[model samples]
Target: MENIGVRAKELNETIVTLRRELHAHPELEHDLPFTESVVVRELAKLGLDELKPGLGQGHGVIATLRGKKPGKVLALRADMDALPIREETGLSFASTNGNMHACGHDAHIAMLLVAAKLLADAREELAGTVRFIFQPSEETVDGALSMIASGALENPAVDEIVGLHTGNLWEGLTPGQIGWKAGPMMASTSTLTIVFEGKGGHGATPHLTVDPIVIAAETISQLQTLVAREVSPFEPAVVTIGKISGGSAHNVIAGTCELRGMIRAFNQETDAFLKRRIRATAEGVAASMRGRATVMFSGDLAAVVNDKACALKMRDIAANALGEEWVKELALPSSGAEDFAYYLAKAPGAFFYHCSTFESSEGGAECNYPHHNSKFDVNESVLWTGAAAMAAYALHWQDRN
Candidate 1:
């Protein structure tokens, strides 16, 4: 484990090259043929024990490595989907396929690949099994669930799992810093859609028509109170109305108004309470205004609660791989959501963030843009830290068991 830093340094350039290649040819969710091919080709070179391609749709790749002695199985996951954002980074390898790796999944794939190579080379010293999972459609938050349904965590049966995100989502963390939290690393996400139906009439004849717009406005206003009045002060929750559509013409009162929003919470009770309150408030407001309303919920992702022991082990592993100064405990959980939560529900695991922003002469503003932005990019020099951390964790986890 002590040599992990040196090994990561040796593979840094190759990891960066692979990351750039993936960035230039970005692909979106579940439909990554070329990206899958590149990953498969690189993994094949490592001479793994068994390579299983096209899991859960024809994009995910699962590679298994068996050690000389038997112990326990460890799973390492890396997402491989790009965002729909157009590239604005202006880098030579910037994506041109009308999509970009704005969230640094490209770097995740490269780091995991290099980690696999490092582990495969040291197979003789290994103990149990290592499962390398390259998942697709992580942006949509269904890839992990699909992979689980397809038995990505079975066969050898994963004892513990580790995943990392390469980005500057955690504020104040430099490029080499690793952010870890013991519990509730990320929030759950739920989509709430409400439709208000009312009578349509000329705008001038306000008395004859029941305006759904007014009802929608009232509903939106009341929905904000769910977090403030209903949820406990200690709990963290966010209700955001991202889209609203109602009238087509200024002079006409529309018959139907649509409201779409998202709810984020750290626990199931809070999520359920928010959903219930949203439906009741929207429907009640519409009914009182002589209008009808329908509420629909979809795309639910659970919160990522890290196992206490796993999180501590990951912190120690990261500290060993990259100096202790590079590891930092996150003060709070992030409101952002990830599909990796699905995997954690099935196995004891930990998900962490790797600060990918490095100080450059260009300026900090350009290098530290938030994820999902068109200009999002990572400092390639620190890519090895993630690889080394994952490799060290897997090797040490086997020895621990």
Candidate 2:
């Protein structure tokens, strides 16, 4: 057996080069021109002629590496778009503009590109076909659906799909360490926008004016109770108001206030129930204060549920290939939502995580920053481990066929 780990060091320089280049030119969601060009150029260098670029419009690319024998098809995905955050890591390759790849999408893209190269090199020995997908807009507009709609999922008819995200959730873990959970791995998300309307009046008005700001505040306060008073405490859920806008000055009583947030849940019933309660609470709170409230469920994403049998098989593959210590059994489900849920919704697959191993003593090592922070940065050494884990899983799945 040709060990995938042994091939890691040989590809380190190329991986670093690719990661740095992408980092320097980060693109926002649904608009990844330079990133796509880089992917096309690299795939061309690997001599994979069956290239299918523009799979999801801006920055998605799909390339198929043929194997020695026909068998089940496997699809691997990596998101290409960066966030609107400005760079603060101060690296030599820090983003040139306001947008940044602060969520480690650079690493994800680089690892998947390296996997394509490695798989291409081993094509003669492989048994099943491997389809490489470079996805776009994962940070924004549900890029997975766009890719699937563009026929990225079907041409090869993948029996199983796999992808990895980098995170700093665990301490003392090695770079490239893999985490897996069956059932609900990530929560479903529903965006809510609530607008409250009241009569505009002077701040000095004694008792004649209905204050929308007060109503908005009351509504925000009452919205918190929906999860606590209505939903089961044992069933974890969250409703967070991410953005609120209303008054422009302190001396004027604002006539309108807008609250934007999302509701997150692990189950369908809980998710639906929360939305119902939120709407009811918003309207009730507004009406009690003689104001009007409008609530809308703007958009949503389903929870990511890993196929139990596939997760178990990948765990065994990781234990065999990367050692027992590399494979972790995750107990708590992730509260954050993933559009990878869209892919899992259509086919059986698993979305895994690789630890971004930033040292705890480092000044910027606060795990509190989370994934979307503009200041967020991840340890880069996990690139090789992530590539190897995906490659190992693909090979093992082929064996099962």
Candidate 3:
């Protein structure tokens, strides 16, 4: 395979162009028509004109680039949704509307689009087919499952899958630096919402009302102990309650209190244990306090477990293409959840992070904002590196398979 990293510098102009356009018109999950059109048009320019759009109900686009020789199918994925955050980056190309590319999906789309362009240009040098997956709703609904359900994983019969995210966790490194782990790289996520129903009465009447506010408080407190006491310390599990709403008036004993949160765990056993405990504690505590409780898991994302062999393959690619310094053994697990977990379950693959090197040392400008935060901004220099790494990986696989 030709050295893709050497050619990445030439595509820097394309990277900036695509990133700016994508960042300007940020779209939300399942509603990325404008962004999808941009991707489709650009992909068509790369000879992937025979496009398959609306794979995941209006947000997923799949395009094929057949190679000269027959080999296993390789799928390259990029998300196309933006967060609801108002862009604070102040860049000229920042999101014009309330939507912002705080999660770096803008970079993901641009990099992958460039990858398609590179692969298409190298079609004669390629050994196998390539599938470009532009996904939507990765932020909230985890649209990967929908794409898989719609047969995006079929036709080509995806032998291996690859994806990337731009985050500042490894702040000082340059764009091509790869962040990955052998197993359990990310925790599985389950959204838990519990509603407490209690009798309402005047605040002055102490015994007349079954105060749900009080029950909610108790339930949350006890729920904390579920992990500290029940689950093993060796296993990583986190239960967080982010939203709570109750009575409107201070003088009235509220009839209902709603609680919303998420449960994250590295293993399925720990996840199941936490769910069972949450249900039992919420219902049991509410019943004892003269209130009823209803609990349900709203949205779920399975844990991202990188296949061992695939992870090693990625490390080798990073070392060769980016250098030894850029490839490091990532031991820490990301507490966040990703829909890519769905893909790994179907086939052997790995989800790697592209270092969005930010100036974290300068306290005046906090560039390393966590995902889902309104102020999150990514270092744009990594755009070309991510594209190069992905394209190189694909080419390597093409040669080997």
lDDT of 2 by residue, 71-125 (tens): 8888889999898888877788888699988888988888888888878787777
Report each candidate's C-alpha RMSD, comma-separated, in the order given.
1.3, 2.3, 2.2
98, model 2: CA deviation in Å? Answer: 3.0
Give the C-alpha lDDT of model 1.
0.91
Quote each prediction's TM-score.
0.97, 0.92, 0.93
lDDT of 3 at 124: 78
lDDT of 3 at 306: 88
The stretch of ten residues in a row with the least summed lDDT in candidate 1 is 392-401
Ranking by TM-score: 1, 3, 2
Instruction: Tell me how candidate 3 scores on lDDT.
Output: 0.84
Once fitted onto the true fold, the runs of candidate 2 whose alpha carbons sit more than 4 angstroms away are: 169-172, 248-251, 360-370
Better of 1 and 3 by TM-score: 1
Best by TM-score: 1
